[model samples]
Target: MSPYDDVEQTGMGTHGAKESGMDERATLLDFPGADELMAAGQVGEPSAQALSGALARVGTAAAAEAAGRGTGDVAATPVRRLSARRRVLVGMFTAAAVAAGAVTYANAGAGSAAPTGTGTRGETRAAGAGVFLNDMSTVAASQSATTGKYWKTHTKAGDTYLSQSMDFYVMNDGKAYKKGRRPDWQFGPKNVDWKGLDQLTTDPAKLLQLLRTPAKTNDIAPFDQATALLGDTPASPKLRAGVFKAMAGLKGVRLVGAVKDSTGRGGTALEFQEARSLGRVTVDPKTSAILEYTFTWTSGPSKGKVTHDTILSMGFTDRIG
Candidate 1:
């Protein structure tokens, strides 16, 4: 008979334990309880699948018990076969998988993952929203007249390039550059209103503050929003879910990503073959206040595919106190 014949033919005998172990092993082979394996750097898609299957079996047993149809022996079979550590690992993987699926479902117009803890969920959501709004406000306030600069650079033959400097000034009375008084070589037009350096100088710590703000309500900061804004589409539902989950607990003043370098010299601005995704925030590592943050997005289309390395950098300007 086949190796599995005894397993299939028996009820609960000497072969039962062996069969159960084999079943658990097979379940693990398919899903492998990613959380535990990942801790040991062994989790991947295959492990995820196996873990999912194992969880499904456990769930089936629980459901059967709830219906009063499952015997104690039947209910305990899977549990008794798997070790406690393996069970915990499977549980974690199951949670992650469920969360990822929930995100996809929510986005496709299904239920929500917004928790229902003792006002904790609402508080978390509010905190995340507040951080995002504050960061936006800070960035907006900093984009004023005296502190902004217009810089231009060009790359022609792989290694050789040229640079040009320009000054930005905003006039409230609307009379700074008149008809003939405009600069001889205008990058776009005199009407191209731009913020000045004085405004930028008002917030030296803005970048740091924005990067450290919480981005998620229950998990990590929203690295995805920054990535999406920079024009990178996430590759999978899991990735999308992970990113949104992360954003709920970020702490920062302003976070901007996907900056394209412009060369005003030519009519065509050279789009960085790969978009640069970066974040800036203040962070307090000791108290979790997030004194400074500048995590760069290193995965996606722009990584290692660009003609030249595009260094996207952000600096914090001190607030005008």
Candidate 2:
């Protein structure tokens, strides 16, 4: 049997405790619902475009490994677990593999394992995640204020088409456009204006309270509203800090430490689970910027499918370009 088969089957090495040829230090744990995820779908053939995007997302190490070999030739590469700072790196690589057609990730169930330098199970730690967000509030509050003619945000959203991902841009002045699609204000949440955004209260509690008002938030969940505001607007430092603080107060926001965003930038991930799906938001610990937001449908018609909205760049820009 191939090494990949071994990983998919027993998930153990010769000694029955460690992963073969990967990290010997971390113990191999059976993830919950491994059988189900595996049965859901098998990894299909990797497309050239998907492989190129994956390699580019992984950066130097994976690139160096694939330097001589063509992208398709690296199919034999062994998957690794998350370890210390490498957690995000491995996550991105594994995600790329998934996007490249590896549907069954062996490490998905390692939610109970603590993140060391060896590997991660992508589990959430409640207390740890809360503390991290509170700290981020402080970090965000210290950033210098910025302003420009328009608040611009560039995003790469879910693959609803053959291209595998959709790229779009939204401007605060009610203009939205994407490649191969006509420009419209319908790309983002409706009724959000720069003037309204500027007048938002900087107080965390009041801001959250206001968001909870169904009329102002368009009846969207306050958490979703807050994250949407954070991602699409160039809110002031205090307002940005307020968003973090408000999120910290929300229950079930767990920390999946040191995971990479869709763009492959390492950041801390905060997740909240609803009845039908799980939503995760990754933020840069240093800058407290929202890097990516992913939603995975767990128990619906869309079960096992994942969609990610990644903020490629966001700030006050002189022109909407």
Residues 1-321 of candidate 2: C-alpha lDDT, one tens digit per residue: 211222322344457544443542232223222222223333445678877877776666444443644555333544443222243344345435533443321112212222222222332212244445555565576567987765556666421111111233443345544445222211114344455555666777776566555553243555666777677565688878777767666666666656877668877676777777888888776567889988888897899899888987777655544
* Residue 212 displacement (Å), model 2: 4.4
* Candidate 1 ranges with C-alpha deviation above 4 Å: 1-12, 16-20, 28-89, 92-321
Residue 142's lDDT in candidate 1: 19
- TM-score per prediction, in order, is 0.21, 0.50
Write candidate 1's Cα lDDT for 60-118 as tens digits: 54454436533444334544343333443444434433222211110111112222222
TM-score of 2: 0.50
RMSD of 1: 21.9
lDDT of each: 0.29, 0.54
Off by over 4 Å in 2: 1-127, 156-192, 211-219
How far does residue 293 in candidate 1 sit from its true spot (Å)? 8.7
TM-score, candidate number 1:
0.21
